[model samples]
Target: MPTLQRVPALVASGQLAIPVAEALVALPADVLGRVQAASIDPDLADTAAFSEAYGFPVEGGANCIVVAGRRGEDVRYAACIVLAHTRLDVNRVVKKLLDVRKASFAPKDEAVALTGMEYGGITPIGLPSSWPVYADARVQDAPEVVIGAGLRGAKLFLPGAVLAGLPHVQVVEGLATPTPDA
Candidate 1:
């Protein structure tokens, strides 16, 4: 993994969204201790650009995508975490998991407005308490991974196991599939 110049995320207030900073503060000491934040150019916040520019393997980056599922008049939202090199199994796994008839990536504006985070920086952390966070099993095996910091100007680094342990996060096997030629 690439070594980043980082500080405890809780203390990197300016680089984090308000809710993200607050969430880090509320984490248990052990979990919080392993979370770190590093500032980056907002333009490089996307996974491909971030990995290439920062010398981190693309596979070591986690992408959090917001999904919306609907059944009749009821709609549910979830955050799905998948490795940068994989594709989330939304049509199968997530649709079944949410117990909805149809499921798809939430509109960018809806996601941003609901999460209170920028479009490219919506991390699983600090999401609404009612939203379940589904993480691919592969994420838990990574020794460390880079994830959004709830802002486009920074990223968070932590052990994958730590991410799996966060409240509301459920590790689901085969939640994502490797992208062809990735």
Candidate 2:
């Protein structure tokens, strides 16, 4: 059986992985300064488990994502962030925001391929230059929040104000919700 690879840490804390640490180090000094992360052994696939395991508080963290769609012959990609408490209206809000006939979550494989990061590890800071990112206003209200650092088993804690400073990050609202099946 193949052995699972562990993440490296930016700092020698023996907690998270190194690449995640590198990214945190690379963040502009003007942005939120580095903060500590809590280690957990659970699949943070959803908000509840993610919040519970990390103890970072869902009401504070922002749900960042990459959304894409095609309009006629044009394909577009967008980096979007939503608050854990309020879901973005993918159809009504994103469709209108992108001004495309159809909008959908970017294909999982395509996202992983483009980012060179695991499914849950993708973050806006290291994405391709073409990505247009959007952040919700709520993120600006928190003192510190944890977000993916481009890998599972790793996360970065920074002030909410720092995420607002990313280029092309628009303050949006209503990106996701507890759907009947979700």
Candidate 3:
């Protein structure tokens, strides 16, 4: 775990993206209490770098990836959270779930623009209500996990159970596969 000062995410407004801060403020007190925010170097915000620099295990980091599914003229967007050590099964599981012929990572510019968050700091907490959040079942097995704070300069820490219970989040089995060498 990071030794950095942890504060209620709701009050860490300056360290969080505007949408993320607002989202935390809207959560119930009990749910809000379980989430904490810590500041980090923007340069090391990526999972592998942050984990190694801060002494947090890479596996304890959850990555929120924006995905787009296209069917005819309709395009649906979703967020998929998977452990840093694993690979999201975007081509199979996500494609099937979205009921689309093709599903893939959203373009960086589009993701950042749509989420109002930095490219490397797109967290699921502040995503649009219409977007489904697919969280890998394995995430709930961890006591706690670190995720982007919607800003590269900070990160959020919360109980895995809390994450699974978040609004619009669906715990999906086999949403991800372990990386070959991870």
Candidate 4:
């Protein structure tokens, strides 16, 4: 667990997406206290590049994805969190979960605008209240995981359980499948 000094305090970072600082602070100390948010090279914002450049293990990185599902005239949005090595089960499980006829990744620009986070740094922490966060069970089982800090130049390091404990977060089994190596 990292104290406030090792990395910028979530409350102290103006670079974070809107309402993230507030949402973070609202989490229980057991969850929030363990988080360490650090600055990074914006160019290394993507998980694979960041891990390679900084020597972080692939197992330690989590990827957050935003998706929009349509059920007839109704549209719903959700956020999915999974290990970097996994592929999100968007078309199958996600569509069924959302009770929608179709489900797809949200457009990058739309996701950024809706979440108030940078394109590569969109996190589940400060998503619109209407959006639910679905975390892969493997993610919560991890001892620790690295994720974006709502800013391209920053990253968040925390116990995976902390993320699973967030409000509106549901730890779902098989939310992702292992990715086949290319």
Candidate 5:
């Protein structure tokens, strides 16, 4: 396993492996400057695999999911943050939030393309300016959590409060629920 490094050190190395690294440089110390990152094998970016391999507690990580919905000819997108052990309330909540008759997870290609992040690494930070990021209440309750660094090879660690405070972020009540089968 690769060592966890401070964001500044990663930036100083000039070998930043993720697109979000460049963006993170501009964040205030209260945010990105305090983030910790660890390099991981891209193949294990998925939550279960990454947690088992890296010894990260599953609940200590958050997953960001992209949902797309359409109303008439206007299409909208939003990123939802939930704990890995929970399920996003996509059909009901997301659809209602988007004010569309239907909403669904965007296809893999669309998510990666629009977010400018890899499929397994989409994050609320640095998402398109117009997109809104919604966090489940439970996510904001975490002391610190791991999230994608916009590259499958890296994971970002930061205070959950910092994440809840990102621009264009909304903390929604009950945005997620324990997975039905969990």
Candidate 6:
């Protein structure tokens, strides 16, 4: 395991955290210390690569992302967390729930550009302050889930309950469905 930095020392005290990277810095100290970071391909989006390279099962990992959609006049951003074995149907489920005309995965370039985190490494633990987060109910039942460490080749293993404490998370049951092969 790699070195894990405790939250308090890694983050400035009393600063309203932004960027999933900074938010991760706000996690409980004990949990923060349990995380590890690894470096991998910058553009890798699929979980198989992350699993193979990191020695974790792709289908058993957590998939965390921030999505962009229109809600009235606002360009709303919401974080969606799912199991790697399942796929979140952004158009049917996410968009309709947001009451928007369209909701798509944040464009690859846009995701990388805005989060300042690599595409394969986007994790909900630390995300921009403006984004709302949603976690599929299934994830909460897992013994442990692997999430990006805001960087590639690196992932964090934490108890599922920690995700529920995120300020903006809304637990939903149908955010994702298991793939046929899974």
What would the per-residue lDDT of candidate 3 be over residues 27-50, giving only the tens digit for each residue? 999999999999998989999999
What are the models' TM-scores? 0.97, 0.75, 0.97, 0.92, 0.90, 0.77
Score residue 64 of candidate 3 by CA lDDT: 99
Best by lDDT: 1
Model 5, runs deviating above 4 Å: 1-19
Q: Model 2 segments beyond 4 Å from truth? A: 1-26, 32-42, 173-182
Q: For residues 29-105, could you state the per-residue lDDT of candidate 6 as single tens digits? A: 77666544444454443577656755666756898877888766777777799988888978888897777887878
Query: In candidate 1, what residue range of length 10 has the lowest lDDT sum?
Result: 1-10
List the global CA lDDT of all models: 0.93, 0.64, 0.92, 0.84, 0.80, 0.68
| TM accuracy, model 1 | 0.97
Q: After superposition, how far is residue 23 of candidate 6 from its true place, in Å?
A: 2.0
Report how far off residue 36 is in candidate 2 (Å): 5.0
Least well predicted 10-residue stretch by lDDT in candidate 5: 8-17
Which pairs of residues collide in candidate 5?
none
Q: What are the C-alpha RMSDs, in order, of all predicted structures?
A: 1.8, 5.5, 1.4, 3.1, 2.2, 4.7
Once superposed on the true structure, which residue ranges of model 3 sit more than 4 Å away at CA? Answer: 1-3
Q: Write the per-residue lDDT of candidate 2 for residues 1-182, one digit (tens) a residue.
A: 21223233244234434444555566656552444454444367355667775455777666667788778998788877766676666777787778888888899999888776667756665677667777776777678666666666556566777776665577765545543443
Candidate 4 accuracy as TM-score? 0.92
> Of 5 and 6, which scores higher on TM-score?
5
lDDT of 5 by residue, 68-113 (tens): 9998888899999998999999988888888998789999999988
- By TM-score, the better pick of 2 and 3 is 3
